[model samples]
Target: MEDFKFTISKFLKRTALVLVFLLAVLFVFAPSFSLAQVNTGIEFGAYTGLAQTDVRIIIAKIIRVFFGVLGIIAVGFTLYGGYMYMTSEGNEKKLETAKAILKNMAIGLAIILSALAIVQFVLNTLLNEYQAGPTGETTPPIGGETVCADCGFLGSVIESHYPGRGAMGIPRNTKIVITFKYDILAGSLIQDSNNNGQFGDTLGGGNNDRPSAAFKIYPTTGGESAAMAPNQFDVFLSVDKRTFIFKPKVLLGSALQDTNYTVKLTDAVKLADGSSAFGAIGAYSWGFTVSTVADLTPPQIESIIPTPSLDKYARNIMVQINFNEPVDPLSASGFFELASGDPTKNFQNINLAIDEGTKPLISGNFKITNQYRTVEFKTADECGHNPCGQTIYCLPGDKQILATVKSASVDSSNKPQAQITANFYDGVVDMAGNSLNGGGELRINGQNKIVLEPGVKTLNQWQAASGKILDDFSWRFLTSAILDTTAPKLTVITPGSLAEKIDVAAPLNMAFDKPMAIGSFKEIVLKTNKDFNINYTYFGTSYDALGQKVILPTQKAVRTTAEIAHGDFWQKSPTAPADTESAIYYPFAPSLLNDIYQNCFYPAVLQNSPRCVVGDISESNKLNDNTPSCFDLQNTNYEGYCSMGEPCPLVPAPHNP
Candidate 1:
């Protein structure tokens, strides 16, 4: 009996030791298994349906599995101890050994339970800390089992918002604007009592109805609880109903300088058809930092297209005026006017023109673009072919054209026009409600020294004057019979063709032989043949004072590749085989790029031509074994590469067009 008891005790001790050793091995190699799963893109745990491989989540899962195994071992030992006690068969020594084993099993079970509870508590605390970062701002949860009060799954209802996500140096008094791909239901944004898709409803107190909770803005430091009250802001919809503007009753970030603020749109927002705005993913949110100072500096004219007193100006050219800052689109569209013939006779009240007996000579459409800073006027008449491309519009030949931008606070009857708010004037105000400083001064050749009226230096002074025109701006130019047919051509391309060892964050620089229309460059496309998952983010496009040279700065490249037995894993594997890592510029399409004279970059004759410019971006002192033809990656049958000349054939004879 003594021998039997000793052997059973020895066997149990050995089994326990083996189990502990196995558990330790699993704990030690758990990270390797997790990484392997991540590399293979495998999903596990109850969140198997979610496409998440966050390291913290993986670690938590591993810990859970380890504790689960421990619990199983504890249960197994309890069962084995019960069987040993039941089979003891009235032997004192065997019964004593079974009782000891049962006691040990109970202690082990208690320890495992306690450890699990402690671990679970720690993990929950850690996840909360990770979600609410150092700034106390709760990051939008991408994928998780944790439930949040104001949180919902990610969605793509919003097209764009200003101040953009993670944007810094935002003005405190700036109004927030959100543009959606589809028209929104007005009632979803504000309390529309009449439900006419307009803000005409009034409460019994005679106050404007408050906005709905669909739109929220709050300081991130204080979380959602500190959100601005609905009554503290007013909502206005655009004429198209695709844009909603939120104007706070007071300035934002007033209590602190350089404060971070978050904007959220809940699922309650709906489309014009009454469908959910954020479809599957219920909500959308972003954060931006506001500056301490407000935008109090009034807007000024930056440049004019048909320069003042210029001779032989193209008849087909569009008149463009650029402002120093983004101006209210409403103000620009209503206050700018154009006419033909003498300004003293044909132009009056800065709005009327009598070129053809009360009929305006230049009847055309006004387009406000470049983020509302550029206003363009295209005449009603279309001219024949010009050097740039087909002429879109034309002016009368041998005629003097006059353009005027008014800075009046009131209309011709001296009554205030429609106001954006109680104190915000409607006539030529900036985004922050600062009126345009157009007081009798005209910016000619990018200088403010050209003062038309000596005493009118401010909008207020201009408004006090008796003249119909108060601090208005006017420029005169003569149109000739000759058409500017010269199209702008590419002059220089930085990191010239096939250049190597380029910095990942380097700006793509391109210079034009002549000043190109700044708006036309928006069509240019820059892409790389790296992994499809890896992408580049262009910050913004900037140009020299001449608008001839453009610089496109991009964010630094992200690290996504890792070396494995079969070459680079994430970047050049079988799934993503373009290992050359080259950046290609697809030639601008016809009619997409235009010169100042409205001439298309690629003539209509060459609209079907294939042209691509390639720039190698391989690492220094390294060569890729697989350098396929550029056309193979782009999937286009293009001719040869050309930086500044005619397009040539790059592929074999049959592939050439």
Candidate 2:
């Protein structure tokens, strides 16, 4: 401890001696350089040294140089102190010594800066007082030379007025005014050699100062810009020749909303002394977007699936979404909210995206397709089937699922593109980087539960139709596929197929186990078993299976229709044999008949469903029961309620649907 204290004391003594030496040097030169020059007027800048026009400038420069040398020394000490601190490790003595060195360096720098600032202030204040007189504070000195950074020895723009850079909501009648660093060559521009009061020079070829133009404005929308008619705007120079202006003879009508414009000071513009306006330097241009009206156009959500339009849905459904415009994909990770319809819970009852339960997520990745306008989310089941190793099928729990899309997922721009609750990651955005409104929803796949009873079951095909793997596009029953192959039953026939003394006037009628489809009866031909020919005209509305009942004329009244009545004989042809045994064949095509369910009519005594076993109608099984009902034409019963043995109940009427 004694040795450490000795070392610190010796270092302090050395630092004190150095400071005293520097102070002595400054004091020695202080007399030669007047310290009280508060009233002395000086104009030369601190840009030069030695024998300059201004004594104050020389002193300021020398002081600055001295301070610069100290700054370098301080920097060196700082670096060394930092190295000592780091290398000291756990040595308290060395670490403390390094810290002290750094502190002293900082304090020295502050003192040097304060002294320099004091000198500059005093000099400037004295100059101002001398130039402006006692109280009229004079302005600061500006650039006197024509020089630029981009182009050597070139002048630049210093000021402007009206329709300036980034100026918005400009009035249509407003004109452009610009101030350059140097006075422009108006003599060459307007060709004032004749000294005429009016300007009619071909040198200023275009109104926008074409060829060697002075100033021009263009539309930033990348198309044909709005233009004023010729002679509508005139360009001229101010009296001092430093300012240029474009004056309009007529009104501009209205400025475009959300449109930008670019203004440029071409390089062709020359200075008053015949030098380049920018000293042969570069052109200067600036642009800004403006609006005559407030920008209120926001991004919109084009569509979403599992939408309200879908009345029912199944498990393993993906969430599909669409936007009216393109949006940032990275910010779309926040488009999420999953909950149940139980009303008591927020997200507990739902398991979306595989096993992603009620736990709220901080991030999500989305796949954008359909021209980058569509968003799709694959469920666990969907992903699993496609080898993505995720399953997202719905499990039995709440009947309804409630999902929502945050606005931040859509609008990822700097400002709110719309008045929405959601922001960049949670909402939507347009290609213009406009954010979408916040309020949005992610709906449930279905409203009610679909009971899965025994036998074959099939899920809807539309939901699985999208995505990379293209899942069979349909779901199947856990067991096997079941189908109904039972053909329709022909229960009863009206006119017997073989009747000896048949009433020919009685139109034919048939009944099926299920109501036979309309327009079933096909062909009816007349034949005789006798050796002579039988040419009886067989005509009677063709035994309509779907029409008004044909009522035969009363026995006493004259038969008006040309139909074969009772006791009618067959008409024999002239060249026919003595007896042609002709039989009336009512050939029926059972294949053309069908039931309401599209099952073709099958002719059998009794056939039960499932196995569709044919059985007898005695006590074993009854085929004439109402289990398979039909329309009774004889009783004029429109409703197909004619069960063979029982009275036809008030069944609904049947049409050819």
Candidate 3:
């Protein structure tokens, strides 16, 4: 009995030592396996093999397998003990040894099960935390929030909307228009019983289906609880699927005076691929006040590009007409006529000359932009070179150009006439269905007289009666023989280069030597190295009345927090420049800027040349012998801080030691 007990004790001691060695080895090598999982191409089933990449999942599986093997060993020991006891034939020592073995096996099995449960609980908790974001929301997978082009995932945003946020005095009849940055899923907008990506319903009719709850509208005082029913309003998606127009069954603010309303678009609105349109934001909402009165006034011409006084206008210039108010996009097409001839010619003679092919009416396509308030005419003839590598459209150089905005005449039946002659007609109207008021007195046959109420004659008839059309607007301009080949240059930077102690709330101002295209302002980017919490508000680009100089107040800074520090500050190095010794820094990229003629300031030819660097104000300035002058800092046509015809030196007076 004593020998038997000693043998059992030796076996138990060896088993425990082996188990400890195995556990230590697993822990030591587990980190290497974790690192390999990042780029591993291995594949295996969870039950039968190992396919999981996460280290935690892999460790859990390994531990469970180890415990399962131990349980199988314990069961084998228990069976062996039962067989020995039954075959002992009432021998006390043999039976006692069998009982001891059985008791130890049972304890080992219980411990194995308990350890497995604890490990599983720990792994499950870790996995749940990993899947959830910092805010405990079930967000996209790690690094999946970024907008990707080919991935079909975008940071969905509202580009613009009619009756803008906080807008007051908005016309009651104004339709709610929301333009999105990307195309949306049509089914998400309204009821699509067939599951097809289309609205498939008529406008302003009972047949139209109610839109989904993703879009909502309600009075400001009542909040979303008093939201209007989906059936009360009809939604129409634009042909491109980027814009949605919401038209209420009844006019807004019909009974109330200056009522405030809120419009909300929830994340339930989806992309074509069924992803949330609002992304992580969940919803977008804005409020506007609607006036009791409706918009009844006609849209008028506010300004025209290539003004009548600009005799040296570029031949490749595009004619732009700005309207005082938004007009119907359909009404703007084919109503503008451009011909080269004397401005005083009668409509009949001009039409005759164009019909007989004696005079060339510049053929071009019309594009309505600026929220349907500006019309641009791009001629078919291509000429000149745009430094930005864009195609240039041109008009006949060294010729007198006469531009006319045609007006319609009332027919005998008192209805607006559509087509009177090939080149003579009028259909330009505003969003409120009112005709264009070109700011001129009513005239017939060269006499100031009212022919009929709501039955105004055509511009052609009015021109024949008097020297001018009743409502037709005309302008004359001349084009130069030379095309605009000069690229726009940055003349001034508000905080100035290498400036110090700049206010945190000051606007970043940039002025160009010539007027730049407002649309191209998007290319100018601001970059920083540190993670600073700052909100930049875009104030939009603008030009002076003369249009000679363009001032781009790109952003108004709003400082939300104090400056952040990484480590030690104010390091001095022999190789480091004075510009690098700054507490806060922002770098400007002017290479992307372009002029109205599509000429780039820093063309590819000047990419290797020295360029001006807009540094932060907090940078320390120390005199360096190799420092370049303001002129030397410029690339190609960029003026930097130096004026035209100004002398430049290796070092400026301000930098002299």
User: Which candidate tops lDDT?
Assistant: 1
Candidate 1 lDDT, 1-657, residue by residue in tens: 567446545745664565466456555754444233111222222112554344545666777897788678768767877888899999887788778768877776665676667556554433332111121223332232111222211112443456655678888888787656568887788776335444523222325555788878899989889999987866655545655667677888964668999998888998889998766657777788989987766676665666654346877776766677766654564222353443212222123222244445466655455555566666667777533224466777777676777653544452222244332343566667665665453323444233344433554554455554554666666788867765545555554444433333334555555545554444443422221211111112224444431211111111101000000111111222111122222222233455666665532122123344232222321112232223223324555544422232233222111
lDDT of 2 by residue, 529-648 (tens): 222221222111211233333221101111111122111223222223312211232323223333322333422212221112123222332222222322211233223222121223
lDDT of 1 at 467: 59
TM-score for each predicted model, relative to the true structure: 0.53, 0.21, 0.47
**C-alpha displacement of 323 in model 3, angstroms?**
2.3
Counted clashes in each candidate structure:
11, 47, 3
Model 2: residues with Cα > 4 Å off, grouped in runs: 1-160, 164-168, 179-183, 187-212, 220-233, 236-244, 248-260, 285-657
Residues 371-474, model 3: lDDT tens digits: 55556676767785443345677877777777666445433342222222222224455554455555442112234222222233454444333322556555
Candidate 2 or 1, higher lDDT? 1
Error of 3 at 249 (Å): 4.5
Clashing pairs in 3: 445-465, 446-465, 446-466
TM-score: model 3 vs. ground truth? 0.47
lDDT of each: 0.51, 0.37, 0.49
- Residue 516 displacement (Å), model 3: 3.3
Error of 3 at 177 (Å): 2.3
